[model samples]
Target: MKLKIIAPIAAACLAAVPGAVAQADNTNFISRPLSLLDCLNIALRHNASILEAQRDLKASQGIVIQTRAVALPQLSVNGQYKDTERTAIESFGPPASSGGPAFSISPPVQNWNGDVQLVQAIYSGGRLAAAWQAAGVTRKQAAAQYDTAVAGALLDTRLAYYDVLLANQQITVQEASVTLLQKELEDQQNRYQAGTVPHFNVLRAEVALANEQPALIQARNNFRIAKNNLANLLGYNLPRDIWEDVPLNLSGSLDDRPCPVNLPDAIRQALAHRTELTALRETERLRQLNVVNARSGYKPDVSVFAGYGWKNSQFVDPGDLAYTLHGWNAGAQVSWDIFDGWLTRGKVVQAQALYKKSQISLADEARQIELQVRTAYSQFVEAGEVLDSQKKVQEEAEEALREAEARATAGTGTQLDVL
Candidate 1:
């Protein structure tokens, strides 16, 4: 009866074995071997944040064009027609009876006029120049912001890729443990049948084997979740049926490279190379230009304008058309905003406040970046040490397991010892 009860449990455990082994043969889907650089490249192209940053940079370039337009000449042409029902005249001195001043006037029923005008700014205090400078600085800020976005995306992709690799390794480790327990269970059963060990040994081995099943299941689940997350990061919408189809292999190991040893040097490098700080500095420059622009209101603006036009009683030139009645005019003018309810003063105050705010923000960002650099350097060093220690432990465990199996097969060790 004991044998009968144990047979089905053993069969069930063996049935679970094929799943771990047959995963190697299930290759009906896409397979890609990706290195860290490969993943970074793919993310740079498809990541939503990076694409949005590129668009923002293009928008900043457009603003530069708009601001520069103030320094360029503007031209316009217009035409109009008018019809009159009657002509009337008023005399102030005398009428026809007095014969002092009298006149009869006839006016055309329809008139046409066309005009072309050009205006160019000769000077606007320093407003136009400062505005253009601010726009250029803003464009540079956008470029720097885009670089920061790319760096952030690259870091996130690296972490996700490492997660997938780690999960795959865990699955391998769990499978090995399950296999060892399965073998020990079988040996215990053989010894029980030979009447050389207690039935309790068989039960103990079965319990140990069963305990590994839950861990194996958990490891496989973790691996699948990790792969799915990576696929999402790569902008893939894979279906459940195709989960096993996409096989990913990483081309490198985490411990293959040496960590940076000098923490102070790393922090300095981060501060110098980080795009976020560059963007903040550019923002400060832009705010300074804004203050200059606001102060420009105190000075006068100078401009030159010219207009040429033609007018006639008829829409088309008459057959007799003497001169076409064309005229032209040109002049330069300067205008000062003597008073405007203290608006310029208010604008200057606002700009100064914003500039001060940017200064504080830049300082805060520098401190945060320094902290991040130090933390990352410390973690990198610690991880390298932990990896070395884990490798040694793995090697020792394998050797011990091998010796326990050899002694069990020679009937010189108990099943518990092998386990």
Candidate 2:
């Protein structure tokens, strides 16, 4: 029996063995005949999914900036120009002899106005503060998600690399078997020709070799497909419509390693370090902030604004309708939804429900992760036992083959056993 493993050999049981696939530097990207570490490095650098996750994390930072801006001072500059033919100047007097007729006093006069305003939030009943904190938590969630994406990419690269190795080994073993069968077939033919063995012996040997051809052909095709899979995981930028071998050769081999870490320690590590749990913890914090934000609606919102503004009427010269005016203004704002038709209450209730749900989800996820760690360790143990048995079985098979050959040569056994 053959054991085919990929990611778990390194990902789950890392540092448990003295030396295996875990000793190389994955950060070196320029080397040829890529090892597992090299493949992992390339996958992390070029994988589309990982890149997308990083972009998402950057976008979350923007969200954090926007939310925090709500609590900080805002400065703005504005300008406006207007020309109007109609005015109250006609009503100012029955007729204007100040210059010419009323028509001369007002004829599409130009006016300019400008303002520089500063607005600062004095209070928000905790709304702005909670929102800002929630945004920060959202960024944390994005960071955790990015970590998860990286971990997943590394695992996929490992699986693809292992697939290529497994298929290659299968082909090598099958070819060897075919060679031995071919020799047995030739010997059978020679013995039959000399009238020393029956024709049945020749046919049996031929059948045995023929049976291996289909499997051998399949193994070769599988090797090619596995290479393609590995190349895809490595994110090769190949031309469209071309099916080819991997650009880089693989230099790493799967060596059997020992598992020394116990199940309890594995579970503890998974709990402390799993990105999914970290992301969920961030979600729980975000939900708590949402509750605070909702409760803010019960209190009045307050802010203050100050501005320097210029209006045409302040220094308007009716003679030419030219204006050059500037002034300062300041005011405080207060808005209270003392009776909002129960809207605030409903919002608070909804936020509370969601926060409670997040708590339950976090707890459930922790349990599931613990169970997963236990299961994985148990499987690893079982696989080790099976591998030990396979070694013993191989030794027994080799000894049996030698005995059969000796017996056949001594004329105490049929050629069938050797074949």
Candidate 3:
């Protein structure tokens, strides 16, 4: 019988050895307590998802720069060196009078050319402007996505933190239950020795204490698991023992404060403040700009270009190089894609279709947000009511336990009553 009880107890203690060792190994680190905001900050800085979102936002900004650069003046310098075999050039124009021989000339054997060219887009039929604006909108969308990531991380941290707190409270309640059961067992054993209660009473008390022990053990394990989960959300590695030893000191209870926002107000706030909605709006605007840019393909684009260059047979010109064998040219160009198998028309149609899709998506997202807000508000209210009723139940249970103990001490109650 002794081995039967001791075996399970021993197994439970052994199962808890790793956590105890972890706590002992980092006693000093475990002494500090983390607040909810501290966990949020840590997650924002180190969480992999949040970091990925930040990187995407940076890439979008780079794209904006790339698109805007198309409208700016472009300048380039180029140089060429050529080594050629000499060749004779002949010209005959109706046997130039005497017709002695056809005129012949030998060209230079080596040549060099260098030029600096500048091109400025005087007009692009709004293509460049629309593209740049679309890029800007995309950047804003990325920013909104990043905000959404942060908000999600914050919410996860809050939930995990509260979970750990809730687990701790449960452990406390289980431990208290175990303590009361032990005391009642002691009283029943004393009464059995005095012949006031039968041996059955002692056996019943022992069974209740045994049951409470396992419950308390399970609660402690759950508390450890909850803490580990919270640590993960705060970007700590569980295997590395970074937060394995840290004791969480949550300051408040789960339902300590009532939610002040009502259903309608909550929905209104979510619609106005939600980053998902903001991102969808920006995406819609970007798609609208894309339609404008596609239509721009039908219009003519105007641009001007100028180049200054020096070309000579020798690498260095010795006499009046600026005036001799130097060239400068400037010209303006106009280009219009009159037809391309209806390609521009196809592109405009595609963009318009995507724009319409985004409009529908935006409306759907707003509905989802409203649903989430209402569901959360209702749950919050229900939880508060449940907590109040549970508190009352707890008080009544405590009073009943007190009265049972008093009756037992006065020899007016049976051991079954206390149990």
- My TM-score estimates for the predictions, one after another, are 0.79, 0.85, 0.80
Candidate 2 vs candidate 3: the TM-score winner is 2
Considering lDDT, which of the candidate structures 2 and 3 is the better prediction for this target? 2
CA error at residue 129 for candidate 3, angstroms: 2.4
Clashing pairs in 3: none
Give model 3's TM-score versus the native structure.
0.80
Candidate 3 stretches with Cα past 4 Å from truth are: 1-31, 85-99, 192-199, 237-255, 313-324
Model 3 Cα lDDT, one tens digit per residue, 1-419: 11112111121221110111122123243345655555666677767778788898888888888877878889999998666654443332445567576563344455567899999887877888887787778888989999987777666666667778788889999999888889988988888899988899889999999988988888888888878776666665444455433455544354454335556755676789888899999999988988888888888989999999878733233222343377898999999889989999999999999999999999998887776666665566677689899999989988998898888889887777778
Instruction: Determine which window of 10 residues in candidate 2 has minimal summed lDDT.
Output: 1-10
lDDT of 1 by residue, 64-115 (tens): 8887788788898989877666444232444588756676444455567788
Top candidate when judged by lDDT against the true structure: 2
Best by TM-score: 2
Model 3 residue 215 CA deviation in Å: 3.7
Candidate 2 global Cα RMSD: 4.9
- lDDT, candidate 1, at 282: 97
State residue 367's C-alpha deviation in candidate 2, in Å: 1.8
Model 3 gets an lDDT of 0.72
